[model samples]
Target: MHLLAFNGSPRLRGNTWTLLNQLKRGAEEAGATTEEVILNKQHIKPCQACESCKKTLVCRIKDDMAPLYGSILSADMIVIGTPVYFWSMSAQMKAFVDRWYALDLDPIRPRLAGKRFGLVVCYADSATETASGVVYAFKSAAAYFDMRFYEPLLVTAGDRNDAAGNPQALQAAFALGQEIAKP
Candidate 1:
């Protein structure tokens, strides 16, 4: 299986990054090849409402996002990990998601239909409320995109590397990776 993970946290060593790495380890152990893209590191322009891709199956803006379209198409499972900011996903994550409009074309819809999608959200606050919007965004997007949505892994980590110290959070992420490995 080919599993692709997108890390949307700006901090390269933050909780979101740690959880995604642990998840990657589990996926590799399950005999799946994995590729990861850190959104913060990439130069992605915000999606314009031009609607050009709706017909052409391509984005008008040329940048790092061009290649990810192929990666998304090739991967068996696509996992998106992000840090919650102001009760929502990070700006990087939001931009990445907005770019998905390119794949919303009718011809490409079948390619994504029933594909597995996983969400991992990290926040400093212990309350689930802090990241509910992000969770809902992924959940609703998965449904609209016709992808098989898995239960999200929501973790609370106040420190940058706190997720690495939280065994439960790590295990949950690991389990998510393993689950995605199944056919």
Candidate 2:
């Protein structure tokens, strides 16, 4: 099986990236062919609200997100990792998630249905508030697409690489990865 993970953290080697890699490592150990995409490094434009995807059944903007369509469609599971921003997921993650609108078209919905999903969110303060928004977003999307929602990992006070010091969060992320990899 193939598992795709999107690291939406702007920091290349911070807490979010650290947890993302840990989770991916567990997925790899679980025998899944996994790939992690660092969203900040890619040039993915925000949705323009042009709604051109309705008739064409594809995003009109040409960028890195185009290639991701195929990977997202074919993957058995997906993991989203991001640092909290404004008590929610990072702006980068929001854009990427919103772009999934292309796949949510009525005719194309099947491409995303029944897949599994996991969330990894890190924050500096009030983990509850930061994680709640992100968790709700993912859960709503999973429900809309009939996908399985795996347990989420929230790292509190992890503005830097504080999450790496939290053994519990690391183990939880790894376990979630293993769980989603199971048939």
Candidate 3:
């Protein structure tokens, strides 16, 4: 099985990346080939809502996102990792999520059907508000694509990089990965 994880945190070694790496490690140990893409470093354009994909089943922007479409569709599991910003996901993550609109064309809409989706969220505070938006976003995405909604892996106190090293957080992340990798 193949798993694709998109890390939307701008900091390469930030808390979000650390948690995502934990998930990746578990998946790799389970014999699943995994790739983690750092979305902030990629040059992906926001969707223009031109409605062209409705007929062509493809996006017109022509950027890094095009290549990801195929990989995303083929992957058995997909994970979105991002840090909470203003009580929601980062702008980079939002751009990528919006681009999924391109997959709305084919008769079997949302090429992600049957795939398992996992959400990894990092937040600065313990307040549930920070995670609420991202959780909702993941749910909506899963619903739209008819994909299985795996339980989210959330790391609070994410304001600091060392937060990811917390024993409890790491344990939770490992457990989440194991659950997602289960048959």
Task: Give the TM-score of each candidate.
Answer: 0.97, 0.95, 0.95
lDDT of 3 by residue, 31-121 (tens): 7778999999889998998988888778999999989988888899998998999988999999998998887766636567889889989
Give one digit per residue, the lDDT tens place, for model 2 in 1-183: 888999988887888878877887788889988888999988888999898999899999999999999999999998989888887888888889889989889888977888998888888875376589889989999989988888788888555768778888888788877888875
Model 1 stretches astray by more than 4 angstroms: none
Of candidate 3, the 10-residue stretch with the lowest lDDT total is: 156-165
Candidate 3 lDDT score at position 137? 87
Off by over 4 Å in 3: 108-110
What would the TM-score be for candidate 2 when compared with the true structure? Answer: 0.95
Instruction: Give residue 131's lDDT in candidate 3 (0 to 100).
Output: 93
The C-alpha local distance difference test score for the whole of candidate 1 amounts to 0.90
The number of the candidate with the highest TM-score is 1
Q: In order, what lDDT does every prediction score?
A: 0.90, 0.85, 0.84
Over 1-183, each residue of candidate 1 has an lDDT whose tens digit, in order, gives 898999999997889889998888888888899888999999999999899897677899999999999999988899999999888888999999999999888888688887789889999898988988998899999999889998889999989979999999999999888887765
Candidate 2 segments whose C-alpha is farther than 4 A from its true place: none
Choose the strongest candidate by lDDT: 1
The residue-level lDDT of candidate 3 at 1 comes to 88
**What's the CA error at residue 7 for candidate 1, in Å?**
0.5
